[model samples]
Target: MYSTILCRTIECLTRDPSQNRKGDPGVTIYKIELLKLQETIPDLTRFLSDSECQRANRYHFIKDKNRFIICRALLKLLLAEYTALDISQISIEVDAHKKPYLPSHPSVYFNVSHSLDYAIIAIAENPVGVDLEYINKEFNYKEILPNVYHQKEMDEIEISKDKYLTFYKLWTRKEAVVKAIGKGIDNDLYKISVIDGSHTIPSSLVCNQKNLYVFSFMVNHNYIGALALTVPINNLDDILFQPLPR
Candidate 1:
């Protein structure tokens, strides 16, 4: 249970030139409410490339298609702001592991995750990964325990006052780390232990000889969010949360 912060939500389109400048040594998390952006779907597509549009069209459902467009559009807008480039100039490419990146601006690192009605984009000066999950209290989590949680994490959750929250806390942590490492979730998640015994502070771990720091927080009572970074967070203020205008 890392210390949680009440996200300081703000409009995603708000421009804070100083807060998110390229090379700024910090992270900013942008939240977008997909359900609120239904009318803007057409406008959002203007920010995406032809390939992105094609990918969105591949989704079987309109909701999923719109969600992908919203996520990518907001991502391009945010990156354009940080890189001081026109949104159309941003060319996003993915690595062999399928983690997205800006080929022209290697220094600007980011990751995006969405669940249900919302999506989050985390941008940092260094490599970063983020995860957002809607807490489904009624979902059966026992079947996933063995495949995803480490033995220690399973034990900790077994005795947790709220097993559902604990499950998500650790689950998001693992997902964030894998994203940060540019590895897909198909890896052995059970081998990753996020229980560092240090509550209230970012958990530090070494993966593939890379030092990673993870922080978990509540994105409101309904969603659990986590961030993984290649560098340690020097100040809590380094992480900013700005929710897009509904």
Candidate 2:
């Protein structure tokens, strides 16, 4: 399934500001390395709202705290480009499902996900969800598989030579689908399957009498990522992969 999906690697450190003036008709994905933005922490903090700052302060560890700050700050920076609004003036609100949206710009829909080293944002004209997972080989997938993955998915992972990578691929896809629906992990993870070759779309779920599509990809050698969107896969073209400036 991944082999058929188009994935591009972006190396630019900056983007044209004019590109953000309007939302793309298709999906636009922005990738950022947290370490690259560490120097701008102070500036990023200033762009965050009071509520965001409070939430960042709640992190128990300094690293965790900074990760939150960098992710949020970058989100605002990218969003500012798309909305053509001042970074500080970008009003963000969470829905009942805890998915963040631009209240002033309802047509723009987006979702964000981060792994240990990278943060990714997916923007589209419709509802979208994205997930990124850092491949951890030492972690115990054996104990957690049954609870989150369907039996068929578990069978694929168990028989694989590299169970760790397989697990993350399936996990990110399921997460992307739930996040696309704005339900987060509250939905049953086992209900979706990415390994079932029959479902050409990465994963699928029926929501409000409509079907959602998920597509998985390899973000880098170390990270596995997935994107879920309301539009059918065939209708999605022009997925731009750009790197956000620090």
Candidate 3:
């Protein structure tokens, strides 16, 4: 699996930035016809699970059943060609930290993350964790930063010119690693240090942890992406990369 897959709203990329912020994030709907595409990849058909999916988490303060439909749909569409099965055949489970796994295909483990305009699904045969964060200056970093990082990390902020953004890069990377380990913020982040100085990525990023490869990407002109994967596997270059057909 990759450290993480960073994505953006194909629609959002075209909209006026101010409008996306002022109004509700536009709703996206999935067409049932795409489900029929499963004929091409029969394995994905199992992922539809219409009964429970029809009932999503209504308790959630915000509602987006359509988003879930499309997210799963997109995943099946992507995997269809590889397994040559339908999108609905794909089955997944979530771990204690909410990491998603493929039960039918135990060799494939993945993590899903999204931002206001983007949804990403990462797949790997190895157990992995993934997280994506869109830096919001309006968001409070101080309140949440301490839970994982210590005073030293906080102190680094004062001395850095882009301390706020640095916090996100570090924060996202830490969270990604935590998720990879199947642990959430409940795990201590003191063990992780993301130091990107003079092209120097820390040797300690995961020296203690064996077989995990960490990678990061910058997105939305400002947001940072962090991903961690178990190593000795395929490097990302071998994987096919493409955006979903919005």
Worst 10 residues of 3 by lDDT: 23-32
Per model, how many backbone clashes are there?
0, 0, 20
Tens digits of per-residue lDDT, candidate 2, 140-163, equal 888877788778788889898988
From the highest lDDT down, the ranking of the candidates is 1, 2, 3
Tens-digit lDDT track of model 3 for 1-246:
112222111221333323323222111111123343434333332356765355444435322554555567566665554456665676666756566666666665666666555555665556555556767778777776667676767787768798777777677767776676776665445646545421222334433344455555655565556666655333242222234442
TM-score of candidate 3 relative to the true fold: 0.65
Q: Which candidate leads in lDDT?
A: 1
Which is the winner by TM-score between candidate 1 and candidate 2? 1
Candidate 2 residue 77 Cα shift, in angstroms, is 1.5
Return the TM-score for candidate 2, rounded to 2 decimals: 0.83
> What's each prediction's TM-score?
0.84, 0.83, 0.65
In candidate 2 the C-alpha lDDT for residue 200 amounts to 32
Candidate 2 yields a Cα-based lDDT of 0.73
Candidate 1 local lDDT, 57-152, one digit each (tens): 999999999999988888888888889999889999988888889998988899999999878898888888888899999999998789998787
Supply the global lDDT for candidate 3. 0.53
List runs of model 1 lying over 4 Å from the truth. Answer: 1-25, 196-207, 237-239, 243-246
Global lDDT of each candidate: 0.76, 0.73, 0.53
